[model samples]
Target: MTQTAKQAGHILIVDDNTDILIAAKLLLKKYYQKVHTTDNPFDIEEIVKTQPIDVILLDMNFSQDAISGKEGFYWLKKVVEQDPSIAVLLMTAYGDIQLAVDAIKAGAADFVAKPWQNDQLLGAVAAAYAHAQDKQKVGQLTRQTQGLNQALNQGAGGKNFDFLGQSAAMQQVFSTIEKAALTDANILITGESGTGKELAAHAIHQASLRRENALISLDMGAIADNLFESELFGHKKGAFTDAKADKVGRFELANEGSLFLDELGNLPLSQQTTLLAALQNRQVTPVGGNKAIDVNIRLICATNDNLQQAVDEGRFRQDLLYRINTIEIRLPPLRERSEDIPLLVNYYLEHFCHKYKRTLSVSDTDLQTLSAYAWPGNVRELAHAIERAVILSEGELLDISTVVGQVTTTAQPSQADSAQSESDQLVNADTFNLEELEHRTVRAALKHYQGNVSQAAKALGLTRGAMYRRLEKYDL
Candidate 1:
């Protein structure tokens, strides 16, 4: 392996003896990429902040009659205070092992005695660098916690982030969210379109350890295949023709936060590999930059498509799927939780009524009609229906037909006469399961359209994606 790939870390050695600093720099340079020497401890904080130094080697006794290591302890305290993530390693004589131990207890990560073995010094430095990496992650998390507290306390749009559902299925989903929020694990939210997958993802982020950070959401479906990398990992100035300046990618912007990957199944196969690599490495190099900056983010991905089926079809990478699907929360569609329809209707009714400055309410009889119908578009459609109804309502009692017309008029097949005829035929014919009737309807639509997916999807009142998924489920 190349030196750059084989070894990593920036080492800084600070000591009173210039020779010791030079010697330590020479020894550690072979094992690490960057090494710098300094004879002054007063500039320790400046050096640490100015440079991305992973480990620092410090001397216990600086000036004459400093054998007690008082100055060293003071410097160590300063270094630790400046950035505890930078592992501080003390260098002392064999007789000062006691002082070194005291320094270690005071926050120094490790210590190496003078006249150390080549192997011993290298091992200590390597271990210290490892510790620095872990501490860096902890530091990020700590900052995120502080920021989250501020946001929640300040009421930063927390009220608008409405997540309401109390059915058994929804309760289970909420339970999963609570359990998974505090950890660094990746989450995959699966549901049909309009089932509030994105809302659930936001809820998890709000509840997570990374909640203080902004939840950076990327709609993989909306992003073009060619611009995928530049969108996620970013590019440096002049990296490409349109590259204007150094732009921070979503990953960087979401540092110490949560990253929500919406419509994750729509991401192309090629970008899937790149995404998997970044998640595995926990680092990214800009398009024109060589140094990989470490990132700490909680990943929450949502998809309406079946990722496992996509993997089987070679449309998605199985490894990438596995990485993001550490904790899968499958959200049930609105049809399964019919009990929540009245509650949802009232909630949206009040929200839209307040916004539109209209006093409106849905009658129980009209709500029953809404609850009885199958909401193919789920809660999102229900919300729209209420909003449109509230806007159109001329009286306090909502016009139920006006509210129901949105879905029925926009999605139903144009052949209204034939649909009515078929409904009458079904009513007069033998009893049939609703699921079977739905399957037959979809299959008949496809046949009528001569297997044209676009026409079939339109006629069947489904998005191409949802129709395509149902087709696979029924092997049609």
Candidate 2:
């Protein structure tokens, strides 16, 4: 019998025996807000279709013509088909225990036997209702999680980047960013090209106090050298031949927000003086104008060049470097964290599958090839390769042919080696001896591989036994 109360639920009881239905309805009236019963199994369908049935108590056996429990099974499937989330409790006699268990396997929430105790019946109904509610909640949460994942995937163009790794180099980068986000000082991000310096800038900005405001960005290298002053500090009407109206500079636009200056090393020496003045004074005087505009903006600058060397050569201002380098964040190239490549690949594969409305899976061989190659362009280049593969995919699974074209288009050995030599000179300047630099390189490689002798040896172009002897000699 269903229990009656101010907040009691509506219940529907289905059985073929009139006496049993009347008795059940009488007992349920004391606990339920509404108790509807039907003696004919056929009438149960119409009652459910037209009424608000919160719980359905179904009899395992109906009339004699309904043998083998076929009718009962049909109605159970129908009810679930109509509302998969609705709770259904099966009713069976002691002799039909097997049928009750079968009904549960077929999706019944629970079961109660005939001639049951009043307390037991009420308990079963309560449990079934709770289970149904839990199922609904989980379903809603699953949909919401999927929606968020889809939105992020679409925003990233179906590519996922792994910003977390276990290497010591990555750990240092993570710690620096975390510490830097807590302060208001200007940050100077230094790293080789394609080493995710911009990503670090974004991460710091997103984690800072002024995260709500827009992060304005300007690539100093992309702008023309002659127009650098006007672009950074704005210009008044007729300030130059092309200047027709007054315009706000990046500093003014980024007020109360963050301004990310990329390729800062490329800015001419004259422009660096102006940038230094702006930072020291917290104000800017537009070209062809006398009034200075005050701004409260955080500065995050990135460069792949050695600014210290530029200062020594009289190409960059020492004063400007001191102002912008209050805090420094350095990022290692992708080759240093190659173990994270497989994780990033799987994430991107799932993302692309959902984005392109295609079901494609990646193979182990594909992952091996990607991890083996040197990513000179780093994560950005890897993302393009995956996108190209997805576009060329023709079946449910990605084939090797889909990636051949992209691999061929990447930087060749001769070009990459030349670039590496130039990059090393630019990054290191002339601060250290060759032998000392070699020791540091070997140590960094060993640390990156977690002291793995074979891996570090391969990375440093040395035999395993030779690397072990050097490690002992250097006491690394």
Candidate 3:
């Protein structure tokens, strides 16, 4: 998957008023990709079960004569019980501060009053989304670490360095990695993607005091927001709908080891705050479980983006930065450290040459030119280019264009752009599109069942999850 795909977030808004639902959808649709709004409180569970909703903006009262948020409490309890990872923000009167605080203690993530400013709503929603994402991540990694095969854990985390380069930049990086690894400090490595960030993280883990323990690595950017918690912290049997078995979380799995969270920037600000809390407390509770598990772990993080800039722009949390980044190690891009290009190219070339059974080699002139060419994708891109050249080599000499000259890239559409593109295709009534017909049939079944997602899914021979995704896709 592309990096952007890993950073996507979704939201859901629930209210009894159609106008409020419409306004919330319109305002939030700009910031979030999957925005779903429903006026019926009964439909909330079905929507949550079927959709990848990160957070919900819930109204406190559903009855016209209701003044107290008793109804809100009922639904909030249901929502929290449905998935403890999903953040619910209660919307109530400005004078309901006491009720709001009570709701928070009861598990409501945050409370926002009625007639809110755009920024206030945006900030709250943003935070809710981030919180859900963090919970999801910690849960996911925990589970993932638990399910990992023994061979996978030991394959390369401690054994590989491949981090070569004796340049001044290289010497400093090597020195920092060695010195920082001895201490249990939280180390944050920053550089462009493909600049060997993961390699550095793993190296740190290998050199650390926890090297005898498992060196668990996670790519924070590639994980989906919905599965984030399940993958990190784990879930109980029958947690939500899909979790069928009790599983261990990453923190528990990395209990006495080092946990390397790659692409730390990919984490949302909401998650950053919660992650900071968990790390500070050194404890995590499994989803759907009230008991907390204590863990002793060394933390290492890496990211491709400038975290300081993201914090300045308010896209990331500043306090969380201070927590994870106790000591910072900046990796110089390959272009800036051109002296290392030759070594990197030769390493990949030799490896690819043997794999493809080709006696091909790069000439001095071509190699020099390649070393001088700007590598926008960094070492990872260069390695890929070399592999491609080896596979397609015609003779003993590899083509220069195929050597670090060709890089792979992926383009993904923004949620808005994708929606616009899907809607842009005008459907002529004269023609019958089977896909359109299927969509209509699904919508009809869903409407007939009054948004009974399970019944509709059964009627359409689809799992409820599949049915919900379609509803989201067609904006039903």
Per-candidate clashes come to 1, 6, 21
lDDT of each: 0.76, 0.71, 0.74
Over 119-216, each residue of candidate 3 has an lDDT whose tens digit, in order, gives 88988888888898889778656555656664274466423437778779989999999999999999998876567878887788878888888767
| lDDT value, residue 313 of candidate 1 | 86
Order candidates by TM-score, high to low. Answer: 1, 3, 2
Q: How well is each residue in 1-476 modelled by candidate 1, as lDDT tens digits?
A: 12334257888888888778777878778878899788878787777656778888888787854567777778889888766678988887745667767888999998788888878888888889899999867755664455445435655332363788989999999999999988988999988766788888889988987776688777776666777877777666667888986555667667878888887877777788899999999998667544466888999998877789788989889899889988999998787888899888998888888898999877887888788766655776688778778888787888868756422322233334434544565556565888777765775565444334545686778876787677656545
Q: Which of candidates 1 and 3 reaches a greater TM-score?
A: 1
**Pairs of residues at least 3 apart in sequence or in different chains that clash in candidate 1:** 148-212
Winner on TM-score between 2 and 3 is 3
Tens digits of per-residue lDDT for model 2, 189-308: 987655667778888888899898756677786677778777777776677899986565777667678888987877778788788889989988778654456778999999867789
Error of 2 at 390 (Å): 0.9
Residue 278, model 2: lDDT of: 92
Sorted by lDDT (best first), the order is: 1, 3, 2
The segments of candidate 3 whose C-alpha lies over 4 angstroms from its true place after superposition are 1-146, 150-161, 403-476
Question: How many residue-pair clashes does candidate 1 contain?
Answer: 1
